[model samples]
Target: MGVWGFLKTQFVVHLLIGFVFVISGLIINFLQLCTLPLWGANKQLYRRINCRLSYSLWSQLVMLLEWWSGTQCTLFTDQETVDHFGKEHVIIILNHNFEIDFLCGWTMCERFGVLGSSKVLAKKELLMVPLIGWTWYFLEIVFCKRKWEEDRDTVIQGLQNLRDYPEYMWFLLYCEGTRFTETKHKISMEVADKKGLARLKYHLLPRTRGFTTAVQCLRGTVSAVYDVTLNFRENKNPSLLGILYGKKYEADMCVRRFPLEEIPLDEKEAADWLHKLYQEKDALQERYFQEGTFPGPQILPPPPAMDSPKLPILGHPPPLTSNLVCNWYLRQRLPPLLILSFLGFMWTASFAVRRLIGVTEIERGSSYGNSEVKKRD
Candidate 1:
């Protein structure tokens, strides 16, 4: 094995990396707790603080994906979508086909400068998990139990709470409601057949209640729905473990933006619109599998990627102060420079440690479950 591959297989590296992730995450979680008192004083300020705090936690995975693994994402979308990204509230509809799909989505969010403000319609159990789950809890991510009766009021209120959100946010939803698997596909297709709906070969039939409810609750706040289809180019089986191993895979994502105004406002009509949208998503996946690319001219992801500082390591270091400037000038510039340097260094230090570390199931677990849609407790 090559030197990089050899280091990835080592254990001490993973432990130190995990220690940093777990410890720093706990610290950030505590910091989020400290922001609770500010909420009553200024709701918007509290949200702004949480958004930034959320980024420091979430970007580590993006760092691993981009810097350590060298994985890159190619976007297939019209220039209008590219132009509008990070400027408005959007609902991201993604297919749950691979473990790293969420990472890929977050990479896009980071590129667009909204990673700090990203939200999700996650299951409630996910909130109890460490790091990521805890981070989401503070970021005001809406949670569900998948039972419409029990979740209806709670889920609606959670989504409605975001209507007055002060920052641009991406609400990620996996309408498939579960990861794709051969058995699940068989069952999902069976449901589609029973309902007289067309079958989807690559994706499962969408669960529409959550989608419709979210659109209805966030009507005045959300601007558009981003219908995203993600697929690997070389039939690679992507997993968090693979990333930890420093294996790279190119993710091709085709995004189609649909304005909320055009979607049918009526519940039944809205559900029908969602179903039709999924059918189109299925066709996109079908085409991708056949041709190895999405239909539109591929739009490369926005540049100046969220790359970690290379160890020797990681940023645009501030301009040096001339000796001619006195102690006052040094006081003004030194602290911020020192702070950025320390933060950037620790950031790379942690990830370089991960380069040596290994992955556990928990380290690699999905917000949703693996291989099935069964609830996590």
Candidate 2:
């Protein structure tokens, strides 16, 4: 293998990358915490600052997927569907079939200029994880315990908090609840049989509680539901570790937009609608397996130059100049420098701390020796 390829396989490289991510993430999390006082004074400005700070941390993982792993993600949907992607608030329902699915979602968020502000309905345990979890706490990401009774209020309140959010956001919901595996799929299908629901060959039955509550709470605030189904070509199961090891894969995401008004307002009806959506998503996956592509007309590729406008889509919104400037600075220039500075500062602080501790130990040892000498004399 080439030197670069050899380095990619080494554990040391992954450790260093992870270490940097954690330290830098914690730094950004601290900065986010510092914005708490500003919340009451200038809520919108506070949100904007947190969004930029979020981008600083999240862009590190995006860089790994886009630059280090060399993964190419393609969006397959009509231009009309995603034209207002970054400009509007939407709930993103995605299939949980891959470990790196969240990262894939983040990549799309980056494309749509909402990476920093993108939210998710994540598991409660994730709230305790360091760095990423701490950051999410500041981002107001909804966390659920997977128990309907326990999560109902928390989920609704979290969704309600976003009603007056300053920037556009894509709230992600993995209604499937857990990552897909054959064993879990089998058990889920059995439950579907017991419930007399349609059998889903490619996906587990979606938990509708979260979706229904989010829709009900965010009613006027969220415009549409983006039903996003993602799959990796050739790799039936893609893990985060594989991405870390520089595995290149092609990801296809098929997004279908549904107006929030069209989704039933009643809780029961909303739950049924989510089930039907999952059934359709299952059918799409079946088609993908057979055709090796999504069932849609391909949008023309954007120009090779980074500065060129992205591919045209239906109902595209005019670019926001402020957002564009923020995107450029955060995505392109800031993350790397911020991470490197954090690493340097951490290293220097650790060295200083160790030296200080050593000096104290040496002084104590000398004092003890002098005491012994005086006693002997």
lDDT of 1 by residue, 203-250 (tens): 888999999999999999999999999998798877776786778899
Off by over 4 Å in 2: 300-377
> What lDDT score goes with residue 232 in model 2?
82
Q: Give the TM-score of candidate 1.
A: 0.82
Model 1: lDDT equals 0.78
Most lDDT-accurate candidate: 1
Query: Count of backbone clashes for each model?
Result: 5, 1
TM-score of each: 0.82, 0.79
Model 1 clash pairs are: 13-356, 13-357, 14-357, 14-358, 309-314
lDDT of each: 0.78, 0.74
